[model samples]
Target: MLRESPYPMVSVSEATALIMAHVQPLRSEEIDALTALGRVLASDVVSPEDIPDVPKSAMDGYALRAADGLAPRRIVGELTAGGTATVAIAPGEATRIMTGAPMPIGADAMIPVELTEERDGMLYIQRELKPGDYVHSVGQDVRRGQMVLAAGTALGAAEIGLLATLGITRIAAYRQPRVAVLATGDEVVEPGSERPGGAVRDSNRYALMAAIREAGCIPISLGIARDDIDVQRQAILQGLDQADVLITSGGVSMGTRDLIKPLLAELGTVHFGRIAFKPGKPTTFATIGDKLVFGLPGYPVSSLVSFEVFVRPALRALQGDATPFRPQIEVTLAEPVRPSPDRPEYQRIIVRYQEGRLLAVTTGSQSSSRLLSLRGANGLLLVPAGETTYPAGSTLPALLTGQLLL
Candidate 1:
């Protein structure tokens, strides 16, 4: 039922380049560091003071000069964690120190309590000790006035811990974007609604909403629009008023009921009608003033694939993320596969480890409408159009989407 379009198809690379040319990073804002998880930093964070400003004991042990090893020494005093040991340790003298306690002055070494015996105010070493053993030197982990985190770094648990260590209560971060989602076609009914004859459930609406949330954007559902032209135009205009980007599903194809393309022509400039790619060939990108619009296919699998390939990057760009593309690695194919003759294919694949090598297994049936093709898939094999068939053990670059085998 595919119908030809009047516009010429563009390569995926060319389309990506054109799309990026219009991207401008959103403005920056300041927020509390505790609630800034997954947000991109707007400026570099510098350490105000060196971590562990003084030499500290890495374990509970006796602190003394290494030359006094294996010799009966007088226990001068006991130092616990969080207490300063300003008393100096002379030859044949030792101080009982707890973990994280500052090392006593003039102490060159530490012997763990297990390797020492104490009785009647005297401490005895079980074996010889080396200087600097079990002792953390000053500024060992971090130096003062050093760049702890760079701009555009995504804040995570580790990043938050680093900020806490530096006593930074607030940080400059980019604002999250609001994305509008609209579903098309009268045959698409809401879930739990009465199913009329030949009507299918509207899965794309909720699915795209979850995908938008996963990309760190707030999703605004514009409700379902029938195949009518006026209804579609009104919905598109309303979506533009509330969202930084508009995403519509099921109305960009060449079918007679596909009103999204014609409506966009009257509202704004359509960058391209179709892309030279599989499963998402009918994908459309356009702009109306400062807002961006994307028209994705109606099929479940096609809709998800289009979001991963295009919408995810756009969301990241809005958050001022420098590198937005998914990480790709070369993996060996476990079975034979053929590439598309006219366009490149993004075949769903499961990446596994065998003999210390990463191998890709096809998820079977790359049909755009078959949602099962994406089940348990962690990678997408990018099979180019130049290759006719790739035999077993052939290497190809694949986009990683799920947990890594490592």
Candidate 2:
């Protein structure tokens, strides 16, 4: 259960500030080197030793003493990679060394073995040998005591390969936030289950599960809860007790069946509900004890948007993510859009590149229950709730959901 009220009703910014003011910094966890791709490193990892640790040959060549190799050369010995030096080069002789073979003692340079000719136990140098020619110097690719991987760098294929080169077997990363989801509604039933006369298939929970995974969090599903307050309370409390965050769809409104708000008041104080947004107007969030509870509307689109705005950021913060919000860009509408004076709208839109400019076309219908409207949409066009009848081709600001310019 939460403590006393921090303040009165706040705008989105104030509410977010008051809510996130005291969230503890994320902690690091363990990750095997192989499974560390796409995870941020928890600490700086230096190269344990100089890469390639030895001055080796880069080509099939002959190792010889530089001062004695002014002219021709005689074959003295052969050195394969991993083989010890059995014979050393004298003044006029050279050793046939394979690629990656260690430079032998007293050998100051390497010449391509093919460049030498021999007759009657004498070696002929077909080409001039320069000091340090064809020899891979020690630590050319990477040096010892170098800070190869900085802390907080997101590991990629190249980073992983570099770590492997340094013999890093494992690393520390931030533990993924554990999220639990519950769907509550007397009219809700599992998808593919027989929907009784008044029941609707449970799609929001599945959508939320997918979204949670995409956001890089672990989703622990607690299944569905019915309309009864006692059942919903028990399920919510149980979820909060086990998960770092609890998300539920439905029962957050003021309807007779709505129970999430009252339960939140009984447990912890409600942070805020009913933000100034369309389709997702019923969005509600609270801190149930220490677990964040997000009450999403039962409608598919509304629930998805609520998760996008609230739970996604909280999960990112819990994971030590530097930037939790999606990218937004300004665009001109291809056609006019009339917006409600009451709630801001994130209208689904299709974007296209025209003459080096991005143009957006709104999809059919703005109803919160329409799922197909968002299928091919690249991003949402945010229209302010205070405006109406935006003119076609006007420079009304639109939020590009795909990227963050910064």
Candidate 3:
């Protein structure tokens, strides 16, 4: 059983409930068959009829009745995948059928043509065929009215092929979540645009955009949001109007210029003010009607870290993905790390395999501003608050950050 957090800081479980309460299901859209890969099925798909629609051949050998397996069979007609054979096989007669060809009536098994020699209108069987040998029974792949896919199963190539077996040419899939991303704060600037003095290149927007796309959603860039309330309000509304999720960076901190929290409160109800996670403690999540809004910290590291912890899950839920977050594994600590009593820490650390064991080692610093350290790291050392003085070789839960895919 999971333990309830004792810290007044809203525990991860509580924070998750607060985050999910604001998001609503996205509308559905019909995408082309080829484009359905990685998309989620909006509803359960049941096979209208038996898959294969008929008993078909799984091999190229021969087709015959399973009861005729007792003696040598007669090959009177041949059938391929696209062609149909009208001549019915008698009690001891076998029809030649290639792979994917539907079996004729009274035929129970398929016999390979290579096993029989044919002369004139008669086929001579060289070996005795077994019962139910080559006949792919009707409904072997899928039965009529059988549930082929659950509502939440995201579509993939294999899934598409399975659906095709049921003659499904078109599918109903969950609409992609329209995520709006904005990099706010006067100090922030776009990556490609000309940079003015004192403006830092906007990495959060690009990183967040990539992350959103990886989650199979549509992401829009609202550029940079200035410190003005009206400007912030307009920007927030633009995201609220279209997107199911609105994500912004650089305005939830304690600085006098920070205006996201107050403006969001005025525009809509703020879901949660902050979380216990480090480097992202100032994060804020709110709802503008049905739109879920996340105000992330200005630092690139904090934005990425918090996204993994919060926004990623929200978007995944919107997409109907079964496994929303990155899979976690237990590893031994390569070095000891300290956590503050006030906040839980997600420290970027490198994990290396040594002597067939996973060992995690953190960089010299875990400050939010250190971009190089975070880039060099491959995993996170998750230490809860007030749990300081961990000795080397201790076991802890770590999130893999390198060489991983959703």
- Highest lDDT model number: 1
C-alpha lDDT (0 to 100) for residue 176 of candidate 1: 84
Model 3 local distance difference test score: 0.79
- The runs of at least 3 residues in candidate 1 whose Cα sits more than 4 Å from the true structure, single-residue gaps closed, are 1-4, 67-70, 83-87, 126-131
Give the poorly placed runs of model 2, Cα more than 4 Å off. Answer: 1-19, 55-141, 329-341, 349-363, 385-406
> Considering TM-score, where higher is better, how would the candidates rank from best to worst?
1, 3, 2
> Model 3: runs farther than 4 Å from truth?
1-8, 29-34, 65-75, 91-95, 112-130, 196-198, 321-328, 331-342, 348-366, 371-381, 386-394, 399-406
RMSD (CA, Å), each prediction: 2.2, 5.7, 5.3
Task: Give the CA lDDT, 0 to 100, for residue 188 in model 1.
Answer: 95
lDDT per residue for candidate 3 within 1-406, as digits (tens), equals 7543222356666788888765555666676655588898878888899766777888887677666544666668888899855657778787777899887777777767677776665566666666667767778878899998988788888998887666687777778898999878888877888999888999999989998998888999998888898999999899888787899988887777888989888999887777777878878888877788899999888988888788987897787776666668787887777886777788888888877788888887777877776776778778878856788988888888676321
Error of 1 at 295 (Å): 0.8
TM-score of each candidate structure, all chains considered together: 0.94, 0.76, 0.82
The whole-model lDDT of each prediction reads: 0.88, 0.77, 0.79
TM-score of 1: 0.94
Task: List the pairs of residues colliding in candidate 2.
Answer: 72-125, 73-123, 73-124, 73-125, 74-123, 327-403, 327-404, 329-400
